[model samples]
Target chain A: MSKLTIVANIKAKADKVDLVKAELLKLIEVTRAETGCISYDLHQDNANPAHFMFYENWQSRELWQIHMNNQHLADYVAATEGAVVEFTLNEMTIID
Target chain B: MSKLTIVANIKAKADKVDLVKAELLKLIEVTRAETGCISYDLHQDNANPAHFMFYENWQSRELWQIHMNNQHLADYVAATEGAVVEFTLNEMTIID
Candidate 1:
């Protein structure tokens, strides 16, 4: 199976930056321990405090999908509801 | 000097996907040889062939800025002119 690369960009409401950031940080530890997880790194934009991105790699798309449906991710979604102003997700594969 | 992570997204004009992708691919080898480059990986969207992204890590923003001004990058810009439809760049820091 081919590796999966996920680039998920999230922007928080101006006033809810910290709340959204905290919720995003909460996902890191648990998600990193999941099966097939290769790398799960979170980044915050230097110019836009409200912008956050997750640059993740998984062994395969199947494993990534399982990770996506995990309870913790659901909790993250529920916790950050309405606080996220924009969200975009891309499932990609390395060109090489 | 803190490390920098760059997420650059490029979208090709509908009819110019191949041209833009080839131009982008021409960048990898030269860029990876530059100073302070840690990783310079490229990805293509699984659902959107016209979308390409470069996920890069650098030792410092200063080094990355130097890379940004290099001749090879200028060449890439020249080569891909009018072939690219959309581009977005984010300079980010890991939330460790």
Candidate 2:
């Protein structure tokens, strides 16, 4: 298993950013607590109010998969259903 | 002059990334050569072929403005006219 980088691009609904933000921060904390997590960061694009990006580094793909299936994630997905407009998930293997 | 961090999120046309990429790399090199530039890096989102990000650091906002007005950047913008779908520019003052 190699190190994995996940870049999740999310766009939350207008005026619901606070609710979305709360859920995302909690999820980020939980993700960081996961055994395989190396680092997890949440960034909101300054110019785009609805745009958000999560930068995550995991020890292995297996551990990352475990993270995806975690109980908390289900709640997060359900809570932010319509609030999220675009969600793009990318898996990266860093070269430099 | 305070440090300036610029995050430029760009979306290029499908299958036209090669042309856009060439322009971007050239602009990046020119920006890096500027006296105020500290670092300039270009990254393409692995899962989103159209998505690109330029992480740039400059000594000041004035220098960044100069970079923006440079002839190379004008050419880059013109060359990538229809090829670009979205371009979000963010000015950040680092806290940490």
List the global CA lDDT of all models: 0.95, 0.79
Model 1 docking category:
high
lDDT string for model 1 (A1-96, tens) is: 989999999999999999999999999999999999999999999999999999999999999999999999999999998999999999999995
lDDT tens digits by residue: candidate 2, A14-89: 8888888888877866788899999776777656767777767799989999999999999999988888888988
Q: How well does candidate 1 match the true structure in TM-score terms? A: 0.97
